[model samples]
Target: MRIFISSLISGFEQQRAAARRAVTALRHEAVMAEDFGAQPNSPQIACLRGLRESDMVVLILGEGYGFVPPGSTLSATHQEYREARETKPVLAFLQEGISPGPEQAAFIAEVQAWEGGLFRGTFRQPDDLQDGVTRALHDVTLANATGPVDERDMMTRALAMFAPENRNQVVPTMLELVVVGGPNQRILRPAEMEAPQLVEHLEQTALYGESRMFDRSLGVISGLDGSDLLLRQERGASIRLTEQGSIVVRLPLDEPRSARGFDPMSGMVLVEETVKERISIALAYVAAVLDRIDRTQRLTHLAIALRVAGADHRGWRTRAQHAANTNSIQMGHGGVQARDPINLLARRAALGLDRSALIEDLLVPLRRQYPTAN
Candidate 1:
């Protein structure tokens, strides 16, 4: 139900206004769409964050004027489209005066390259945009809560398609399955085992969403647990995506940097840009994982050192050493010990997290480079 709305702050005031109204009308709980006068936060950074937490990214492609980085990707809308195409469905709400690529007859070659209706484009008038948004929400709402009756079976079918030769081809970069102790079965393995290259076992599952489920199913989320993970909900908080969806996630992987494609069986996720957009996605994920671990475990230690050394944003090593001398905890790439008072009580601790925010910046874009292995 939580959805994100994003549009060009510089060029499409009318379109952005319409979306703002539509979101209000539909009564979505969370709306993070903002207009930086079409020139906000270096354009790149702003748009990137706008698209991060969105369950469904509704972009306004009106006026066709906004800053977009060249070469790596084209057009803000196009970037959103391509990124959303592989991970989530991108809905292009064309303004009245908007133009299409070209006449079908003239672009026969271009048309052929398109595949299985990855994204959808729709046209709407100023008066009709609200109603249309409402209708779209109606469909999106049903989709988010309840999934198709055969969703599990479909995933089952997809799993069945896996073979021994493709083992590495389908391996998951991150594996999280709940190990339930039968009311009294002895608990052995700890929760969340990072990809253990040493372990050998068939980790396949018949579950739709997560391998290990926590509680009750709230609504009709048949699509998500299946091959379809992302959904557009007019009013919800967190969105769920499956490992398969992660395969389609984008990375900044392009020529110079690429995100290596993933296959659960293959167990490969690379962080090179340009090798393939898919690899970029992998790079983004790699960064996120590193960040999560660093933030949860490393940051705390580093912070301790940083504080003891006088919070001098500069000279991290010296500060770290001083902090290490104060606290006796390690810091840095190789982890060095710092003995100092990190002011650990300055902030309340979280479960390996301080707060929840977008893996924005390079994460999602890099995700674009990673490809879902065939």
Candidate 2:
């Protein structure tokens, strides 16, 4: 596929070189379009026309590198998004650690509404650049193909997509998912999202622990729709529901192996022997996951991680609409209950998931980090 790089040419020199090499390594003919940076109005428009001819646009984001052009409102990257809105495709690669600052987010929210494309992780260096870009591009390709993408799938993929070393950032997504897998494929809806469904399906098939987690998450059928609940497939992902439309928690996932290493941060680091010394990163991953994960299994997974990290384990209580703070207090640690609907610890009610598989991903590392009592 033909790809175009729409970036400010002057200040972001290092980013430019990295982009060129990365795109070259990906074997796509690359275009710099430097004249646009010098004279953003006329020349940039001409460059955009050139980019319009390409199949995909790679937005390299930065701060103070103004290329938004006079009279026109959209930034260079945002404009390219519109350029491909009706046809072709595009993906944004924002700088890591740069949370959408107010003006930036307001500016982006407009383009995000205008164009529907996947924006991958924030990249810092050139070493992991190629892999990161490739992964993001592949996801964008999938998302472009899938359309809007299942919200849960996007975050699930995003958390795992980046270099686990930089696990400090808090990256979240739109929806929740209760996936299942084996013989048939399905996507769960918010109302239909039940942890029991996942547990029962895996049990009937006699699936093992890791297999259950891997397989169950793979076979999500459909999500419930209403006021405050949602579950969906992220756009552009190559997932197909069976013609029957039954919420059957059975089917093979496109990539099962990747799910094996699946530990998207729960607001904490993915700590283990291999992670070196990213305690801070782990802490961040755990903290973010604590807030991001709305499902019970994920919450339990969070609790397990906190415990393994040797934390003062505290069950999540929906103290307020805001966040779960350290100062607040709650009840129980072993599992869940039926009453706590919005309760993160209420495994069955909110997450609607069974005990083992849902919590397994977060717990396995804990087991590896700290063995159980005999």
RMSD of each: 20.0, 18.8
Listed in order, each prediction's TM-score against the native is 0.34, 0.38
Query: What would the per-residue lDDT of candidate 2 be over residues 102-128, giving only the tens digit for each residue?
Result: 556775555445332124446776555
Residue range 83-103, candidate 1, lDDT tens digits: 654444444454565454533
Q: Which window of 10 residues has the lowest lDDT sum in candidate 2?
A: 340-349
Against the unseen true structure, what C-alpha lDDT does each candidate score?
A: 0.34, 0.39
Error of 2 at 134 (Å): 2.2
Summed backbone clashes in each candidate are: 85, 52
